[model samples]
Target: MTAREQTEAYEDIPGTWVFDAQRARQGYHLNEFLYSLMKAANRAAFLANEAEYTRRFAMTEAQRTAVLRRDWNKLLELGGVSYALAKLAFTDGKSYQYMASRMTGMTEKEYVEMMLHGGRSPDGWRSRAERQGRA
Candidate 1:
């Protein structure tokens, strides 16, 4: 029926973001704001008054909340690109592992151990379709 509905058929991969057409459109403003932090001046302004800064970028209230909450999963669900989100993470002086740990619901130490042990167990991880007995 729509481009978004078309993607509903295949975007069921577990524990991942696809950055599909729908997501790209949805996250455009958010990703733009994240990417804008590439400049030190912009980053400074953002850190100064986040709410005002978000407003300046025309970011949705949900996006503002996701940023303020540092809710990485919610940000992704709101169409944020992992690569772009990394800029914000770096601005906060966080490591990629830190972001990954947050996304996976693991403490950094536990996540590091899991990585050392060859990453998370795939058990109990399923797509929406699989969970719904569609796949």
Candidate 2:
């Protein structure tokens, strides 16, 4: 398959977002803003004025919205890398587990239990088309 075809195929997977080169470029500014939270002063500034701080980055409006909303799924859909997003979570005084649980639409306790029990079942829909009965 051609590179474009392969990328299209990757998009078929359910609940999965590939951080490919395209995504890396798309998310460059967003990731940079997120990574900036690594510094205490930046974190404080972001916490003090989220919209203002976020505006400093040249991210798409959708990406800006996702970041402010803390919409983990939407952020991922908009190319936000998980590792970089973790910085935002940390800045909020939240744990990676908490952020992950929110991403999976589960409570922290439920997410923890699920992990302890070996994670999601392999029997579920593997692709979007499969779930739609169109595969």
Candidate 3:
């Protein structure tokens, strides 16, 4: 079907034309339905990338699926490098650092410092602390 025909069909459906009433009343058109579709696509892409990253990084099967589903809370529960994996899926290394800072309760400077120092050692924070104390 044509674009206009498709839009008309969409409007004919009950509770589907989110933009129609608002656009009519306001005399300004905003394609809310199209925007929603784009947002969903973007989210799906992000989830797919998260899955790939988890798989490549050797995450647990359950954890990999959780990231693939964009279950952010489940990702946090997985801990270790899961947060870093999420950031990597979303951005480049520098942007990931900024995003990690925003999402993980750390300052941007702190995030950068951690990256510079090689963030999240394999043994994690407890091992790092012990090693530091011994030095």
Candidate 4:
């Protein structure tokens, strides 16, 4: 398939975001700011003043707002790579499981229980077209 066709195919997948070139370019600054949290001093500055520390990056206003709100799913929608976004979770002294639970709109205990029960079923609408009854 052509690259455009491949990209469109990726778009059809429900609840999935491909970190393709377009997303990489769009999230560059946002990811950079997230990764910056790896530094102790940077984390300290961020903890001290989230809005101020966020201003140092060239992130979009929406990205800044999502970061401030700790909106994990919104960050993903905004093109943030999950791995990079994990830095923010860690900076907040939370576990990856906590961030992941938030992403799925579940409490950590619910997420853990779901995982223990063999995880989400793969039988449900796997794509937007399927969900919309077009496929």
Question: All candidates' lDDT scores?
Answer: 0.85, 0.92, 0.44, 0.92
Better of 1 and 4 by lDDT: 4
Winner of 3 and 4 under lDDT: 4
Q: TM-score of predicted model 3? A: 0.26
Off by over 4 Å in 2: 132-135
Model 2 per-residue lDDT tens digits across residues 6-110: 899889888889998898889999999998999999999999999999999999999999999999988888889999999999999999999999998999999
Q: Regarding lDDT, does 1 or 3 come out ahead?
A: 1
Model 3: residue 98 alpha-carbon error in angstroms: 12
Expressed as tens digits, the lDDT of each residue in 23-111 for candidate 4 is 88999999999999999999999999999999999999999999999988888888899999999999999999999999888999999
Note the residue pairs that clash in candidate 3. none
Q: Which candidate number would show the highest TM-score if scored against the true structure? A: 4
How far is 63's C-alpha from truth in model 4 (Å)? 0.5
Better of 3 and 4 by TM-score: 4
**How well does candidate 2 score on lDDT at residue 52?**
97
RMSD of every candidate to native, in Å, equals: 2.9, 1.6, 21.9, 1.4
For all predicted structures, in order, the TM-scores are: 0.84, 0.91, 0.26, 0.93
Instruction: Give per-residue lDDT, candidate 3, residue 73.
Output: 39
| Candidate 1: pairs in clash | none
Question: How does candidate 3 score on lDDT?
Answer: 0.44
**Which segments of model 1 are wrong by more than 4 Å?**
1-6, 123-135
